[model samples]
Target: MPSILLCPQDTAVFTREYLNGWYSLSAYYASKLTSDLPMLLICPTLFTTIIYIMTSQPDVFARFAMCWGVSLILAIVGHFMGLAFGSTFDLQMAILLVPGLSIPFMIFSGFFIRIHELSAIFRPLCDISFYRYTMEALMQAIYGYDRPDLECHVEFCYFKSPSKLLKELDMLGDLYGHDSGITN
Candidate 1:
């Protein structure tokens, strides 16, 4: 009635069926928008203004939705998160985020340079470095350096290369048992 160009009689049937199929597909996708995806991402993309107002208010609804809502959908229907995301966290290192000596341990743990490289006066400081623990853990994770091989290299490398100090410590570790400590 508004602007009919009067297609051929057979074409009208095909056109009507095409229109119905298109409408059905749009409705199917529209229904999935709520149950299928992250509401924050999907809601705004599907309806921009509605997303803006709901997000602007900053309510508990947003918080709960973040932790629970989408994950629930994933659990029930999609990826079966029960099997997918179990405990991959390292509780030990997480605990060591703080250590006993605290201050100097962080300073000495060989992050910037190895601790064996530090000055002789600061050598005693190595006894308390958490950096040493972190380096030892890293090295042990790769391959454990035996106790003195671990110790003197850590000391000399604070200023010099730990590899060279490692050689010296190899000699020392062979000569001395676990108690030699770091001498000048």
Candidate 2:
């Protein structure tokens, strides 16, 4: 939302400045990215830290780092996507289009529908959804890589075993590296 609102305003000023030969295009772009870097890093780190503790996620530093990294990447991608839309269209149109496009991505993200259960044609959408990859990586970080079985208090626990749960989710393989594009 910040990118969507700010990028257009920045572009207008940038265009005028560039036309007046105030700075090279590359310099302005580089400066803009550099300025935004701190906020990008800080916001995700804060958010990940709070949520990681609040949700009672595993205390392992590596797992927390994985969640934070995935969150940071997602934020960067979302920022760029908003910037693209803001630069390409009017504010109202960009606002409408962003959510409109996101609905399909969310639907295919494997939270509501498993990829294996999806239709063959729609299965490809899951492959492209960043949410799907993020979810997979987070799951793997918290539950995969030979994690022991969860402690179940009830007598009839269906998914006490992390491996069994992953298998049921059709995410039994070690694809953390592939999913997040970072070697695990």
Candidate 3:
């Protein structure tokens, strides 16, 4: 909606007539950012509320904080995507490419496949992937700090600190400390 309404026409008109120069890209970007803010904030906030309630996730505040962060990142990426591909056909191509891009990130997320099992070259991809950070932060938010005790069968009893599990998966829970209180 934003791109369809603002791009290639309004952007040209505003840049040519209003700003006195092409420097209005910032203004254009800001306009899109502001216009989308309400849906961007409301959808994630409401979705987080529903999912957290259903899952009974502890540290609701922290989880909501992380969810909001992820949503904002997504919105920023989406906004840039519109700017990157100004034409409708190009935008459609970018949308088609999203799933292709997501597959590697999903593989490296440590949920679909263990991070340790990934080749050394692929490890860096996991580090860069927002999905990996999102998953790690959510996991740390759920299980960090409190050190919950669980009754486990003999084999599973070896499972200990959530931090240790994070280490085993090569995700640094400490990294998201400020973002979602994943650590102190």
Cα RMSD to the true fold for all candidates: 25.6, 1.5, 4.7
Q: Residue 15 of model 3: what lDDT?
A: 58
The whole-model C-alpha lDDT of candidate 1 against the native structure comes to 0.38
TM-score per model over all chains? 0.24, 0.94, 0.68
lDDT per residue as tens, model 3, 1-184: 3553346675457757665765556776687678877877787678767777787565557656666675566555655655555544444565565556667777777788887887898889877666676776666655565546544557755555656666676665455564333445
TM-score of 1: 0.24
Measured by C-alpha RMSD in angstroms, how accurate is candidate 3? 4.7
Candidate 1 lDDT over residue span 83-114, tens digit each: 11211213343223323334566676565555
Q: What is the lDDT of residue 124 in candidate 3?
A: 94
* Best-matching candidate per TM-score: 2
Determine the backbone clash count of candidate 3.
0
| Candidate 2 clashing pairs, residues 3+ apart or interchain | none
Candidate structures ordered by lDDT, highest first = 2, 3, 1
Q: Give a tens-digit lDDT track for model 2, residues 50-165.
A: 99999877788988988898889888988888889998998899899998998888899988999988999999899889888888887887889888788889999999999999
Report the error of model 2 at residue 170, Å.
1.2
The predicted structure with the larger TM-score, 2 or 3, is 2
Local distance difference test values of all predictions, in order: 0.38, 0.88, 0.64
Lowest-sum lDDT 10-residue window in model 1? 80-89
Model 2 alpha-carbon drift over 4 Å, by segment = none
